[model samples]
Structure formats: structure tokens, C-alpha cells
Target: METPPKTDIAAALNRVLLTRKERLRSKNHWAGLAKIPTTTVLDAFKGSNSTIDTLTKLAEGAGMTLAELLAHGDPDWEVQVKIRNTFRSWTIEDVDGLIRLLERRSGPRDSDAS
Candidate 1:
């Protein structure tokens, strides 16, 4: 399939931010969270030929990984990207802990723990 237009990508990002439900509503707010300048975010959204680095920062500000943001309209792709990014950042200890937690949850429930 052909890649969607930049406008569509921008709209998707706005939609993601809107889903935040009153936490963020402005470019400046997102920029502050992403540690990037407001103009950079605005330019990227406006399709002004921003660098990947700029776009990555914008995505981070919106509580998404770069891959998730780039996945745009594809919900499945976005979810997969989020999962991949999460695993990418996991340390061995974290993975081991998660495995233990999952195993315990799947095992017989402890009345006191519940």
C-alpha cells in the first residue's frame, strides 16, 4: 500500500494527543514534555520537512514511541510497535520479573494476595 500523506500523519498525531483526555492540548505543552522547541513540533506537523530526530521527539512528547507514531493509521502496527519498543527497553532482570509475575498470575491464585 502507498504511504499516507503527511497531513494524515499529522492528523493521526493530533488524534493521539486528543486521546490523552485533557492532559495535553497544545504544541508547546507537548514540546515541553518531549524536551523539544514548540516550533519544531509545529513544523513537523505542518509537513515542513522535519528531520526524523525532530519527529521522534514529537512522538515521545505525545507518549508514543517513534515506531508507534510512524505507524500512523494502522492500529495493529501501532500496538506491535509499542510492544516491540517495550521489549527493546527491558533489562534481563525486568524480563525475569515479568515472567515470574505472569507465571504467578496464571498459577493458582493466593487468597491473601488477591
Candidate 2:
């Protein structure tokens, strides 16, 4: 299948920030999260060219990978990316526990009913 065109980088970054509005109340908050200067964050939001390192820091601040941040248009993919990023630091037992909890909350699957 043909790949969908990506959104502008600045717009994608803005969308991610909107999703994190509760925590990132302002640009300064975002910069703090990214551990970058406020001016750098401002430049990024304005579509100014930034170094890969800066972009990586920004992505990390947003709880996603650099790739995910760059490809941040799809809501479903965004959620999956966040989940995947979270899973990276989890133990297998933690993952299994989460699976069990989710399954319980979601009830039995069709296969289980059979």
C-alpha cells in the first residue's frame, strides 16, 4: 500500500504537545521535560531546523522515540508507539500482569467462549 503523506514537523510536534497539555502546560514546561533550552523548543515549534540530538531529546520528553515523533500523525500509531515505549522498561512479569488485568477488564474473548 502507498504510504500516507506525513504532516509538517512543526504541526506534528504541536499535536503531540496538545495530547500532553495536562502535564506540559507551557513551552517552558516542554523544554524542561526535554532538558533543552526554551529557545530551542521555540525554534522547533516554529519549524526551524534542529539538530538530531535536539529532536531526540524532544521525542524522549514526549515519551516516544525519535522515529515516532517524526511520524506522529496517526492517532492509533501514536498510542501504540507510547505503549511500546513504556513496555521497553517493563519486566516480563509486569507485562504478563498487565495482560491479565486487561483481559479481566475486557472479559473473555470469543475464543474463550467457544
Candidate 3:
């Protein structure tokens, strides 16, 4: 799956930080908790000079897992989330049946059979 755009990621992180009851006091607080440099966090918010790993650390400090952060960060996250959730409660048999059904529908039709 495609990573969220940097701007969206920055916005999501800011939203999380701003909305939490236990608000971050400063960039230094976030940097310490996230175990990254303050400049990294600052640069991330500005959508520059931040690696995925650095951003993930900040997300964790903001009380979000990487996936949760991405869910908030990416506008297109819902589709991928829905697709993943679709199989979450399925049994092995259900998956097999789904695969078989898909294969049948997607395979060559009788009219095309040689």
C-alpha cells in the first residue's frame, strides 16, 4: 500500500497532539518521549527532513500505533482498512470458498474455452 503523503501525516500528528487531554508541552517533550531529535519532530510537522521511522516514533509518543497514525493521516486509508477487516473474522473455509468463487468468476468463461 502507498504511504500517506507527508502533508497528511504531519496534519494527523498535529491533530493527535493538539486534541489529546495530556497535551504535549513542547517539541522537546515530544522529542524526548519519541526518542528522536526535537528538530526531527519539528521538521516532520513542516513536512520536511523526517524519515518514516522518525515519524513513527512521534506517532507512538502521540498515543497512536503506526497503523492508527496512518489511518488518521491518509485520506484513502478507509479502503485498505475495509479490505483488511473483511478477512479478519473469516474462517479458513470461508477464505477458501471466497478464493474459489473469485477464481471461478475471473477464469475464462465457457464461451472462451477452447
In TM-score terms, which candidate is top?
2
Cα TM-score per model = 0.53, 0.59, 0.54
TM-score of 3: 0.54
lDDT by residue for model 1 (2-94), tens? 975443566556666766536667778888988988888787677677677887877777777776676664546567556777888999999
lDDT of each: 0.72, 0.82, 0.72
Q: In candidate 1, which residue pairs get closer than 3 Å at backbone N, Cα or C atoms, i.e. clash?
A: none
Whole-model alpha-carbon lDDT for candidate 2: 0.82
Rank the candidate models, highest TM-score first: 2, 3, 1
lDDT string for model 3 (1-114, tens) is 996465476766676566553756667788888988888888888867567798788878876667766665566655654665586679999989988999898986678658
- Which ten contiguous residues of candidate 2 have the minimum total lDDT? 72-81
- The deviation in Å at residue 100 for candidate 2 is 21
Alpha-carbon error at 46 in model 3, in Å? 0.1
Measure candidate 2: CA RMSD. 6.8
As a whole number from 0 to 100, the lDDT of residue 72 in candidate 2 is 67
7-46 in candidate 2: lDDT tens per residue?
Answer: 5678778877887788777889889999999999999999
| Model 1 C-alpha lDDT versus the unseen true structure | 0.72
